[model samples]
Target: MKIYDWFDGPYPARVRIALAEKGLLSRIEFVPVNLWTGEHKKPAFLAINYSGTLPVLELDDGTLIAECTAITQYLDVLDGNPLLTGRTPAEKGIIHMMTKRAEIEFLDAVSTYFHHATPGLGPDVELYQNREWGERMRDKAVRGMHYFNGVLANRPFVAGNEFSMADIAVLGGMIFASLVKLPVPDECEALRAWHARMLERSSVQEWRAMVERGQGVKTLPITADLK
Candidate 1:
């Protein structure tokens, strides 16, 4: 399997961490899609994934899977373990719900703020930006932090007792927030504590190490034969 993504990207980090958790990191090859160079938006890469997102999984038989949740779901079930997503119907439902909430209320909001309010991917990639809308999204992200803080105050994980895809989704939000210098409010003690514990996970540690190693490395050039 080959995963086309940019190292250190928050969305990619979610899938990378999931791969590490499933002990499948060694089984796959990582192809860097330079986010800074707008490689993902280019025609060559867009052919592989119409959405033009990073962390796309290309199976050995030429099957392509885009979107983090879908990729994680596929990888989670590959070993018949289904650890990250869920095993039971109830677990699946709750996990999926929380994960979607995490994306809408947090991660995606942070992304909008970065792309609009900040000079995200530079002027080349960001053709149109609405600073007003971005600022609103930024505020929404902060409110999301508070909301998650409330959720974490009562439970050990985002979805419930055990860490699931939902936790990873929130972690992606936290990662994006950090990248954009969006500080989690000091009052959100529960969220802060939860984030600290997440950082200690081996999968997250491994992802961090990979990010450190990826720093300053030149990205692969976009080409017609990316496959």
Candidate 2:
């Protein structure tokens, strides 16, 4: 399998971490798409994914899967283990709900603020920006942090006891927030504790190592494990 993505991108980190968790990192090849250069928005890349998003999965048969959730779901079931997604119907429903909520209330909101309010990928990639709307979304993202803090105070994971894609989605939000210098409120102790635990995960450690190794490379095909 080939994954087209930018190294160190928060959204791409989600799927990369999932791949590591599934022990499929050694089997895959990663193709770099430079977000700073606006490669993803270009016509050539847009043909691969209509949404022109990062972290697209391309299979051996040339099947293309876009969107982080879809790719994670596919990978989760590949070994019939479904560890990241969920096995039970109720688990699936709750995980999906919390994941969507994370995206809407946090991750996507931070992305909007980055693209609109901040100089995200520079002037070339950001065709248009809405500063006012972006500021509003920034506020929304902070509110989202507080909301997730409350949720984590009650449960071990975002959805429930088990760590699911919902946790990853929120992790993506936290990653994005950090990149944008949006600090989590000091009062959100539960969220901070949960993030600390997440940072200790082997999958996340692998992802961080990959990011460190990937720095300074431009348009290179980086192996998942760099081995």
Candidate 3:
């Protein structure tokens, strides 16, 4: 299998964390797609993913799986135990709900703010932007932080006692927020604490190391460990 992704990006990092949890990181090839260079928009890459998105998973049989959620679902079940998605019907429903909520309320909002309010990936990639809409989305992302704070205040994880894809969404959003300097609300202590815990994971630490190292346009050969 080959994983089409760019290092240090939130969406790809989400999938990376999931792969680490499943112990599949070393079993696949990592293909670096430079989004900054508009490589994802090129015809060659678009043929693999029409939406021109990163973090695409090509199976050994030549099947393409797109979207973080779908890819997570595929990886979660590979080992018989669905670690991130869920094993039961009730768990699946709750995890999916929280996952979507995190995407729409937090991650997606942060993405909008990055693309519109700020000069995202330069003027080349972002052809048009709406400042007013971006500001609104920023506010919504803050509200999302508050909401997740309240949710975490009652439970250990986003979807209940166990960690799920919902937590990955939160981590991804917070990572993006940090890159754009979006400060978390002071009163959202629970959300802040959850993010700190997430950073302790080996997968996140590996990703942070790569980001801090500033290694650009490098294709990493698969290794046994997260390092």
Candidate 4:
């Protein structure tokens, strides 16, 4: 089976980390879509993903898979890990729900703050940039963080005690937020502890090094295990 991978940003990095964990990184063709050059928005790329986003996966059968969550599910199933997603119907439901929460809360926050606050954070510095969009995104993120802190304060994982894709989704953005000086609130001790554990994962350690080695992030408030 062939995997046409397009990635160069935090969102796609989530898939990279996931694929790496499943030992699929070396099995697939790495097609680097330069988001910095607006390659993803080009006509050729848009034909694959009309939304013009990176991390679109083309399966061996010529099926296009879009959206981070959908791609995660597909890869997890194909990997036969069963545990990466969930072993039961109930588990899948909660995992998906929590993943959605993370996407809306932390992921969206990182996207807004990076594009608006960081210089040359997005594809272009002069065009397709929103000066105030970063602040708006941060505001949303701050509020979301408060809500997440409450939900996370009492749980070990986003969906109960089992580590799910939700954790990966949230961690991908939170790691970037840390890289860019958007501190994770100290009050969210649960989340911080979870982040620490995530750092120990082989997949995360690998990608952390890759992201830091590349010029991908603006800052790294704390160095996660650079293995």
Candidate 5:
């Protein structure tokens, strides 16, 4: 099928990682949506996903999946054993629960501080753009990270030992957190180790090169330590 994939952002990167893990990289076409130029807000893209977000997957028959979680789930179905999302009903439930935890904790926090607290991104979503709300969200995310770090301490991956959709979700957020210079406590060895491992992965390395270059000199690198 024709996957109108957006590989310019963290959301797409997670999908890219999942695709790579399943060995489905060559099965789809990659498309880059310029968020810096406000292309996501443009009419043409909004026509597909009214929510106006990237990492949108479009099927050959014109089917469009908007959210990152949905696209990852769809991609999971393409694998031989369906490991990303889960194999059984209970596993699916846990994976979804943990994935939501990652989003609300790390992902939401970075978005609050980056867009609402920082500038030049344009207030496309006013939900957390204001300073007051942004700061509050910052705290929420920090606490969320701590909780996640503790949860990760005894495990190699999220969702109990095995790498699941939860790992992709959390890794995507950590990359965003690192990009925005979010304070990941040095004491959180698990977080650091996990990020370093992810960075070494071929999928992450490939997508990151594109992200850093595509964002241009203007975006630059917020955290020089990311590499």
Candidate 6:
């Protein structure tokens, strides 16, 4: 399988973490898609995914899978007991619900803020932006952190006791949140604690090591304005 990904991007990082967790890191080829250069919007890349998204998975038979959650769903079930996406029907539903929430309330919100409120990928990529809308979505991401914190207060993970894709999605969102300097609410102790624990996971640690080795830069460089 060929995984088209951007090393520095959070969405691809989600799939990378999942692959690591599944112990399938060596099973696929990682193709770097340089988002900073506006390569993703080019015609060749668009042919792979019309949405011009990163971290796409191409199966051996030439089947392409787009979207982070969809790729997670496929990779999670590839082997073993399928712990990431859940094994049972009810578990699946809850996991999917939380995953979507993480995407909408957290990751997507931060992305909107980055692209709209800030210069984002610069004028080359972000053709349109709404500062007001971006600010509103940034607030939503903070609220998401609080909502997840409340949920974590009741359970160990986002979906349940087990570490599921929802947890990974939240972690990915947090990483993005950090990149944009959207600090997690200080009072969200439960969420902060959970994030700490997530950092200790082998998959996360491995990804960190890779980043240190120059496989990717986990977060974008902070400019003077952000600081």
Q: What Cα-based lDDT does every candidate model obtain?
A: 0.92, 0.90, 0.85, 0.70, 0.72, 0.86
Q: Pick the candidate with the highest TM-score.
A: 1
TM-score per candidate, chains pooled: 0.96, 0.94, 0.92, 0.82, 0.85, 0.93
Q: In candidate 4, which residue pairs clash?
A: 179-219
lDDT by residue (1-227, candidate 2, tens digit) is 88889889999999988988899987777888888898888777887887879989889988989899999999999988999888999999999999999999999999999999999999999989999999999999999999999999999999999988999999999999999999999999999999999999999898899898974222445333321
lDDT of 3 by residue, 42-86 (tens): 777888888988888889887999999999999999879998998
RMSD of each: 1.9, 3.9, 4.6, 7.3, 7.0, 6.4
lDDT of 4 by residue, 1-227 (tens): 33333334778778878777777766666556666666666666677677877676767677878887888888888846665678889999898888888878778777867776776535453356665887888877767777767777888777878777887888777766876778877787767777788889898887777666753222221112211
Over 4 Å off, model 5: 3-6, 123-128, 209-227
lDDT of 5 by residue, 51-108 (tens): 7677676676767776778988887786557878888898999999999999988886
Clashing pairs in 1: none
lDDT of 6 by residue, 130-198 (tens): 999999999999999999999999999999989999999998899889889999888999999999999
Ranked candidates, highest lDDT first: 1, 2, 6, 3, 5, 4
| Model 2 per-residue lDDT at 153 | 100
Model 4 C-alpha RMSD to native: 7.3
Error of 1 at 207 (Å): 0.2
| Model 5 residue 105 lDDT score | 85
